[model samples]
Target: MGKSPDIIKDTSETLKPVSGRGITVMQGWYDKNIKACHVTLWDLGETDDNFSDDDAEGVTLSVQVTIFSQEDEVELAREIKSLMKADGFSFEGRNGDDSEPEDGIYMKAQRFSKFYESEE
Candidate 1:
């Protein structure tokens, strides 16, 4: 087993990646009145060998994005944080897990615990 994959973001340290790749963020901009809010999400990227393009018996790692708010930044942040908890999100399988999609790769939503930030 690896790290428990429980992530809690406090500072930039908690969201940095171990390797020098890049932190993938699913985000959007929302404008309400005079305030323009930006929503960003950070999570783990999983690579499952079991997942293949065949779509028969494959399980890959991926992420899911759902808008939680369009009003206040506080509400938006709250919704984004709620999504970070994977509430409505269930990990039953992949998109085409029930049928074959000519590919053998699949992606599932998973959480990560640790990350590394550069001291620049």
Candidate 2:
């Protein structure tokens, strides 16, 4: 099985506390109604396929986490990074330049990767 579902569930749970009035954490796309801020997760892909003699496969999964804030707060972003790191994800790099997706909402995306071996 792919790690996309697990990654999404872990990410959503990890960032749930950060979701509040203006802030929202979701997988794939951000809510249109919540214009204040958004934390979105996207599955980049899986690689490093390995097959063992026992008929088990292993792979590394990559997921991109984009954080948008309307108030231009750095603390929240920092906290999120810390949380992700603690959750066994390594910071790959910044996806691209920070931009304004909406009027005042600033968006910045960071890539994270984790290795998971199939338990099948």
Candidate 3:
């Protein structure tokens, strides 16, 4: 099974017509350099006992998504949510609180959970 960030990035690329600048792993204050709708990905954590056997392995990953935009991010967020669900990623929930904008860049944080398994 893939890690949170890797999985999210792969899924994001599958979405079409996304106006965002790009999808990439979240780095500290990196959004400040980008001037478009940019999505940042981070790993919150993984489930316990993710390994079942030598040939079977599973992981429930918590992926943190942050949307950086100068305008409202609602539509973009909704598209992302729909695409993620359509791709079989579970929607755990989002942060009740939001982060303050930095340099006219507004941000919204959402958390998504997904379970993956691989058999060797």
User: How many backbone clashes does every candidate have?
Assistant: 14, 0, 0
Residue 56 accuracy (lDDT) in model 2: 38
Error of 2 at 118 (Å): 2.2
Ranking by lDDT: 2, 3, 1
Looking at model 1, residue 73 earns an lDDT score of 28
Runs off by more than 4 Å, candidate 3: 1-5, 19-30, 49-57, 97-103
Question: What are the per-residue Cα lDDT tens digits for candidate 1 across 6-88?
Answer: 22233123223311234233333222331222223334354434324643232233343322222322343333344434432
lDDT of 3 by residue, 1-107 (tens): 34333555555554544634444434333456777667777767777435455443666667777777787678778887887788778887776534465566677
**Candidate 3 global Cα RMSD:** 4.2
Model 1 residue runs over 4 Å out of place are 1-35, 41-43, 49-56, 60-74, 81-120
2 or 3: which has the higher lDDT? 2
Listing every candidate in turn, what is its Cα RMSD in Å to the true structure after a full C-alpha superposition? 16.1, 3.4, 4.2
Residue 48, model 3: lDDT of: 42
Q: Choose the strongest candidate by lDDT.
A: 2
